[model samples]
Target chain A: MKDRITGLFYILAVILLTTIHSIELYIGFFVLLSVLSGKDFIPVMKKTFVAVALFNGVITLAYILIKGFDYGYIALINLRVIDMTFMTFLFVRRVNLFRLFEFSSILTYLLVISYSQILLFKRYYTEFILALKSRSIKTPGLAERYGFLRSATGFFIEKSVKNSSEISLAMKSRGFFMD
Target chain B: MIELKDVSFSYQGRKAVENITFSVQKGEKVVILGINGSGKSTILKIINALLFPQEGTYRYRGEIITPKKMKDREFVRKFRKEVVLLFQNPDTMIFNPTVFDEIAFGLRQLGEKDIKEKVHYWADKLGIFHLLDRSPFELSGGEKQKVCLAALLSLEPEVLLLDEPTANLDPRSTGWLIDFLYQLDITVVTTTHNLGIALELGERGLVLSENHRLIYDGNLSEFLKDREKLLEANLIHIHRHRHDDMEHRHYHIHDDFS
Candidate 1:
């Protein structure tokens, strides 16, 4: 499917799944979508299941204590949430976000920038952690931990500001604001 | 044409560049050579109008480029369209999903017709045509640099400002870029800590001291031959070594220290 069409379909599916109260229908739809999505379905379903179980477990327990064991309502709510989450994962995996938002160039640009920045942040964080691990011969003490945290926070803040400014200039140099 | 007179800039009360004066005629190529943190990139930013000089004037053609002048949409549009800067980090410069889209970005922003053709042309020129459909984030540093170069070059800007273009590139890619840049007829100003690239990029060189002063501006060949000037700029260090067979004297760059 075209990315834009897939995005639109995903949105519609989310709305439909949320409104529908039938646990059987939601389960049927989830199974169908899972099968259609192929290889990524299992992992997506696993993640959605864990997330939904943890979140709804608390709420479902409280409800059961207050009222009674309502298997139908609890099952329906949990299934709906799982279906929505799975659909979102499927959409993300299927669609090329940059291409999906190409209709709005500015939006596409912003998405690309944000995505790159997120990757950069992740890389920086990982490097810091790795460096800390490599340098330490023993467990870090309280003072050492505090120092590392302070330094890491300062570095992250400075890097974020620097990256944003530099990226902004790069965009401007390319006539990104000309339109 | 571009000119800067008595230009100075500071970041958080710390000076980056000071009392800088230089000019480039139409179609002239100039290389700014300096050690790291010597404000070479800062000068490029000022030229691109990305940063306003805190003192003195920066002019393109004849008119002064002030913050007020840049506020004028028309002036900014014209300036941005005419002068383009390739940042030091290609990773920061690339923010598109695919190499093709990244190269086509500037053309699209400028409302250029036949963006595909321009993108393909530059991509082919840069030898990144095969990677066109691939994600820029997945590319190697050299490939990313080529993609960024293609993107900026596709716009056909009159003035090209490159900040440490060869910094992250491998030797082969660096050679390719040098060869490619040597053929361009545009007004080019590039910054580099590598004296070799500076020498290759242009005959004229501007050396910024560690303290952010313009210490040298003239023939690059002459400037490079002067060991004192090079040492003063912190570009190299003289090291003496003795082997079992013989003694040798050489100058080596302290890359990490710099």
Candidate 2:
């Protein structure tokens, strides 16, 4: 029940923030990443932050000089860089790299956060089911329950296979597992 | 062969592992034994290229192992496919939804085209074919461990680095794991607190001390038989039955820092 509730909260948070603006949404997203991956990658995060800060400053300055900061597009791009840099730094200071990347593969990190979200949901449902079973609820229909289970299972299996292949390809492209 | 020379790693100016040097020849089953906080897992991490040493060198197959070489994409992809590390926690390693995909993960990481056939072969070998469609997270600890083993073994890695693989496993599961490991021809480096499994499966043992330093490296039986020495190293105790006296001789674990 707690996990399911928390999962719902996570979805709501994402929805709420993303609706505000791209910059606010980016900040929220990266903050979550920092909290998740800040530990093991602290040193890496520090280095990445410094590099990204320099990169962001340069890019912002160039945009201001050429196109001016009056337009929102440049600010959005700058906001993204700033958000990523801040999150990377926080992540370096806080989370272990191994723990941060614990659930990711090269591909999983890219092309959709759905894989992680679905995993989180599956775990939520499993806990919910166990709790429900513990309460000794009267079964209305065995076939209906079985059908629900089968569909839930199919959903998980489909996502997992697709995500694994996607992550493998992404890792390969990023020079992971390329011996 | 894999070799680490003068490796040192420090976090926030505090050393985790320092001046460590070790070598494992091809096909050698080396067991690393140590008490908690002894840097045993840290050593494995360095070898797997998960952590870079602040000093010294790590060489694999006579060539230096570096991020530059690893960044080549081809080298790392090949290395990971050939030498895989099995983490202590199966929950961490078994990410796929089912046993089949979980076992196929490492193989697929290596770009194996015929994944279905390879997955079947490994599943059958590990005796988990019936559980193929079952969710990996739902499996028991022993089953999860088997799934993890099947996943790594399917890759056919030449060097298998296991960090306390048998830890928290049931006696039956531990026995099965020991038997499976003994049958493998690949080089196996395992860090374990289980003396029984170590004695049965490992021919050589290396003891890591509280200082995160190597204390002893030699024969498993001979090492286990020395109660006084082992106790000093904070290692597990093992009992031997004397045929002449019909009495059990206990080799007590040593307590370090005395």
Candidate 3:
């Protein structure tokens, strides 16, 4: 029941934050939620700032050039984006994604599998990069770097397919998907 | 009761194992021993019906098993529940958010009542009860293996198929697992390249040659003493060395390091 409520709240928050037009309200809610979440505020703000800047920086610049400086509207759009991002971060930190989707076993399974696969991919990619670094005495050239990336990508793709198939078989053997 | 008669499989035209014939009686523990790339794991996959045999038939409890037959809903459910395969990598087998859920997953799928009781029983049996709420991903390699074992064992499968169960485990955990498996009264088919561990796990051994053939299948103790057979299977290599001060040279069998 708690997980369901959390899921509903996440959906409702997304809808409200996306639909609401007032920038001040978004800023206030974002700040209040961030404070209540009790997470490291500066780091959360730093990540949110980077994401907002990268996502809206170009659009804001283009809008200013075309429509002149409507400071209030531009600020509202930027703040809304940042606020939405922060809210999502908070939601993810607060709720267990697997439990949140407990109503749908298939969805929960997919989320878990995808999460593990992503972790595996990251581990493999990091190992590949570390191996490259260990082997190279000096900085690699463009062609060498390209070659390394090509091989790593190939390995990653092959491993992903193999890992997914293995996981599927393992799950099946354990009575999953029997229904 | 599982039987494979003249079973053969290939991957994209590359033959894995061929002309394999074996039958494991109920409550019997059998070990498949082979070096890397010898198709030992492929044989286990075939037994679990994850891969179908291209040429022969597999029988479970006197009924011939085939891909088409497995399509039947009832048979698939029963077969999966009765025969569980614990993957070599615990990471691949573990998909639940916590250890408790991981063990409970199989029972829930089978629609088994008293899921919490069964999960707790097996977790306690495997000495992982304390880790019930912990994420499986956060566990050590041995702990992960135990959690996976608990998950599969909780289902109380009739036939347990393990593929290199100790590959990622430490010596202490491996010892514990061997002892635990010995106490379990269940039919087990395990694969391993380690000759000593295979002897410890089971009385009968099926040795796969480098070319993916069942070169030897008999008493593991006798098989280990047969130096020529071990050499042919590439499980050991004969080496000769002479000390500078010694008058004689001696030849010794060097077991495959891996």
Instruction: Check candidate 1 and list the clashing pairs.
Output: none
DockQ, in order, for the candidates?
Answer: 0.02, 0.03, 0.02
| Better candidate number, 2 or 3, judged by DockQ | 2
Looking at model 3, residue B151 earns an lDDT score of 79
Best-to-worst lDDT order: 1, 3, 2
Alpha-carbon error at A86 in model 3, in Å? 40
B1-258 per-residue lDDT for model 2 (tens digits): 999998888766877777878899999999998777777877777777766778899988987887686666667766776676776755545445578866765555456798899889888888899999998878888888788788877777888888888776877777788898999999999988666567766899988777777777889889887766577667755778678868776655532211
DockQ-derived CAPRI band for the predicted complex in model 3: incorrect
> Stretches of candidate 1 above 4 Å error?
A1-179, B245-258
Residue-level lDDT of model 1, residues A1-179, one tens digit each, is 38888888888888888788887799899889889889997788788787778788888898899989999988887787778888887787878998899889899889999999998788667545533432232344575566557656766786899999999899989999754
Candidate 1's TM-score: 0.59
lDDT of every model, 2 decimals: 0.81, 0.69, 0.80
Q: Residue B150: error of model 3 in Å?
A: 0.6
